[model samples]
Target: MTELGFTLKVFRQIGMMKPILPHKMLGAGLQLVKWGPGFPSGVNAAAKRFPRQLAIIDDAGELTWSEFAAQINQLTQALKDRGIEAGDSVALLCRNHRYMLIAMIAIMQAGGRVLLLNTMASRSQLGELAKRENASLVIVDQEFLEVAGDVDQDKVILAWADDDAPAGLPSVAAISADQPTKGHSKPARNGQVVIFTSGTTGLPKGARREEPADLKPLVSFFGAIPYRGNATIVLAAPLFHSWGLINFGFGLSLAPTYVLRRRFEPTRVIKDIEEQKADALVVVPLMMQRMVDADPEVIKKADVSSLKITASSGSALAGELANHYMDTFTDSVYNFYGATETGWVTIASPTDLREAPGTAGVPPFRTTVRILDAEGKEVPRGETGVIHVGNDMPFGGYTDGNTKAFSDGLMSTGDLGHFDENGRLFVSGRDDDMIISGGENVFPRELEDALIDHPDVADVVVTGIDDDKFGQVLAAYVVVKDGKSLTEDDIKTYAKEHVARFAVPGKTMFLDELPRNPTGKVMKRELPEFE
Candidate 1:
């Protein structure tokens, strides 16, 4: 019997013998096998099981499993014909389109590495990443070709999305039927993707490669969750981001029908969900807020009963927003925690979210989290400290010579959080972003959340300023809604009523707009410093 068959048989036997311990044993075995290395195997298995099921959909077009597989095969052959080989890096700078998905599969099938670049990155940023990754070939969509102007055009394979595939360019469809069939390549034992950090501290650093073993636990975790195989998943976030990339992986592995939106629009998202009968969505907190702020009647009129789960990540989803989503969708909304370096370290199920509003959730299967102090010693439960993740999962270190990110078999996430008595993890904030005022530690998120609840406040950022007496004092930068007028005292009074006295911002500055990155994450470092 084949290894996969034997594994399945053993799994079945264990399932029948020990009903209670089956999940634990299965999770352990999956980790041992480095399940992500078996992605090609899983793809073959899925193709055989659901040959004609719809795989991807966008405004431009849609593709079935068979069509998707054929495209992957053709593209793999085309890339190989051009001298591409296994372990070589291929950078992709494209939007959420069908071609992008096909390219990703083809790259993996050819044993090449994929470097996902944000489509919104400027030419300079793209050049820096391309140089750092040493990308040999760049496959870019026609729209993003300008961003690659600095790079040599001869090294690029421009993919066209229109019906008339560009002439002169290599056609993925013309490759030989027998030309390097898909699913025949060896599984990548090392990392398959090199994701860049969000650059919250400084310029972005490339995180470690993500290995196949890292994905096994995710599969097991999702299996236990309430996701269905045929569920329609709407992708509102940019596909280049980790959330988007992981969702794509999930859809491919689980045989789900995926719907893609070029960009996020609150009204359009609600309309698309209803029109497409989408059953699930993955979004950041900002998107959720925009959706909530849109016409309430649109949400009421939209039929979202098909939605079984909605996942929020990238930033903490406030308790109020979580509750609002649960009430609006009438389904469970989950909060996930992890970085580009780690695929999925923790996840809060709908049940957990409803119970503990702002908790990031408990660690996923086969994953252990340690709250450690500066010296790397484990802190007592309920004491906030840096969060560390340890598992047999695949994780590549930074491309730069920064090995300090990992120590003692644990990858430091640089996040501060504490586990409650119930074992739920609540992220306080980034340790570096923490403010000390009068010798007391303060987290910016706590105050920002409170300030956002104020009616007059459209947006706010709380930062620490040098203080003569207190060592550091809190400052608030506000972006008030149109026609809304408020003074610093009014803002302080509102915040004081909601949060602790120390958490209130001592100074307030009104700004027309706050600087934000493409993904809507505030650029705190760019805020003007106050004396």
Candidate 2:
């Protein structure tokens, strides 16, 4: 994008936020130059500008911006005392809480890079991953002592402890308690933030995002969604996922009061939103599905009317789920479509959801989306092809030094999608997920959408299974609605009516729920094999 184009986009994005004073803007810019882009810069700036403002509210308690900064700076001092410096890697293995987020800032403040480890990952996997990634230290929660055990005990620091540390091991609270409270010096260069992708086939891949992330994503987000400055945001999603991390990092730039929960209980989510009077709610689609599945009586009792926007990403927002959520929440849903590799690609507003169910919506300011065939040629608007995206900040590269497929300045999203005549993008499924059974191509998204529309079908996923006769065939793992009975023949018949015979799954398995990572994407590797 040209300089003029970028300036207009930034102006439009800034215009969407609740107004800020000139001095505050200047202060933020100064922080940006010093600390670069990320939570630390935003935290320090907020401390100066809104010291008494509530910065975070979690299960433990609340902290104002001033206290929040002081705690991180103190922790920074402790890490520096331990000899942490720029470019050192510190893996964070913890759940969503104040300290987990605080540790991320402090690590960077102390010039240690942050490697976010997923809580859902097995202890061995987390340990192995940290070792493979060459992490020198780990900040873990008390609950994950077993995970921490995989590492040398001396290098571990508990970010959250229910009580005192185990066997006198250091904890963030302990280290920071004795440390002097003072501002930390800015690192020569901003520390990098590493996020691992939840790959379906193999062990996860690590993607490193160098700090001060591309402003394009921030511009893309605030340009479409009205997340006002200093508003309250309820982040029920795990802080490790890219989507959740985005709400914390860029979302912090807005200096909003973030409300976090240690766990996501659907009904409790309603209560939190109601109690917090949150202006924005961030979640993945699975959370929304469960939220809508919660008892109607509880939802009706809660007053979540203050929610101006509920930003959702991390997985496909099924057409049925999107409409149902909007119908219940009064059209406040905005579904974001992108990858950990690419930030915000498209945003489906309530109007988009209502008009075209399952549409990924259109690209936001200064972002571009294209449908390209295998040869890297652009396909027509209504044709299915690889979905490629171009924005200011796409993924830098995997830690293993591999890069994603790039063509004509756009990086592949590794998903198959198409655009409507109206310019709305619709993601079908993973590019690698497309199956050819008996010479008939099949996309699981079409069949999943069809089955989900059935009132008895609460949730479903269709995967291709190897078969002797056809080489591969579709297999469905479904979750039936409460008090409903859906049989194999019933599902096959329903699928036959809605999809091509060849596209119908040869096997159907019913479960109470699908196996999903914290971000809500179905863990295909965890699914039971077809019989």
Count of clashes in candidate 1: 5
TM-score of each: 0.86, 0.94
- How many backbone clashes does every candidate have? 5, 0
- Please give the TM-score that candidate 2 achieves against the real structure: 0.94
Clashing pairs in 1: 36-212, 208-396, 208-397, 209-396, 214-394
Residue 302 of model 2, lDDT score:
84
**Over all chains combined, what TM-score does candidate 1 have?**
0.86
Number of the top candidate by lDDT?
A: 2
Q: Cα lDDT of all candidates, in order?
A: 0.71, 0.83
Error of 1 at 109 (Å): 1.2
Model 2 superposed RMSD (Cα): 2.4
Error (Å) of candidate 2 at residue 305 is 1.2
